[model samples]
Target: MYLLLVFRAMRNFIVVGHKATTTPSFSLEDIPGTSGRLDILCRAVTAAFVISHGIRKDVCVYLVLLGGEIPKTIRLVGETLRHLNPDERTTAALLKKALAVPATPEWAMSTSGIFVRTGGLAEVLTDLKDAKLIYLREDGADIRGLDAPGKDSSLSGEAAFILGDHTGMTPEEEALIEQAGARVVSLGATSLHADHCIVLINWFLDTNVFMSG
Candidate 1:
């Protein structure tokens, strides 16, 4: 009966194609007044950067500030077009590049610049997804092919359990995950790290589902 109960529990948790409604598009008016005033250009840039960085929820709050600063930056650039020093212009360019990098879950965990514990990554993703602040695509392609073919395909039952990471999974477990609809992408053969999870998060963000608000 114990084994049967376990089987039943597993069966109940299986993922299937349930029609989830499409997320609405983001609009500037949707932002709360408390978020502060921002120009359209900055809002667009901040949204793009946040989505690219794996949909890190911690950084989303900063978008409110970025929205306001964009116009100021543009005004500064226009005012100093002729008088701007080469060094200052270069510094501004570098700052723009720095803002382009998306904040990741790992980066959020590094409070003191140290590596975050492995267990924390899954929790962060789950919380973000639950809050509706971040949308999660189960298992998908890299950023380049996010819009291409076979992107929204659902993962198989076995694959969902394996990637769920209830406890430490093994090589055999990983094989089962692939069989269920997941693609096991590794940075290196020796590295057991799960990088594809981040890829899926980025894909969701790229779709701009969460940015609507």
Candidate 2:
């Protein structure tokens, strides 16, 4: 029953890659890492949590760190609200802690509604879909615009989206997402930071009453 409850609580997601974790240690001082930038990850996760209405929703956020001592991946389910402090401090602190955590192949609740696991861009994408959630990669391909009217209808079932970090998705990462069979999606032509992209995506989806309903 506990397992079943966890499954039902799953919400749409937004995965972003932080290819800058080239730091040798898991310390916060090392954040915005020489390689993996925690600042980007912090902002991205915070933006994903604080959507248009300011009401928190169930959303999973993935930070794929490529510059870490071991190239780790961290997934945080939306349940970190209780511990989330104003500003990005709380998020930053949690990420610091998550970085020091060991890798887990299965989804494990790090706290209440929050879950974390160690993996990479492709692994997380594959796992979420295997759990029956629809995954989409935000891209500029011939795909549909997230804000396009009626575009919401095309995305049925639980869904998740992926974006790139400061340096943007690596060519290899793009191929990984593509290979996973994720539908390519776009959000206009202008390029924005990963955190900004997340806010816009959530706002667009909220305007459609996707999660609220």
TM for candidate 2 is 0.74
All-Cα superposition RMSD per candidate: 20.1, 5.6
The sequence of per-residue lDDT tens digits that candidate 2 reaches over residues 18-73 is: 55452335455555544356777778877877644453656777777776545566
Top TM-score: which candidate number? 2
Candidates' lDDT values, in order? 0.25, 0.59
User: Model 1 reaches what TM-score against the true structure?
Assistant: 0.21
Model 1, CA-based lDDT? 0.25
The TM-scores of all predictions, comma-separated, are 0.21, 0.74
Worst 10 residues of 2 by lDDT: 130-139
What is candidate 1's lDDT per residue for 105-198, written digit by digit as tens? Answer: 3332211111111122233333233231211223333323322333342221111211222123445534444444344332223322222433
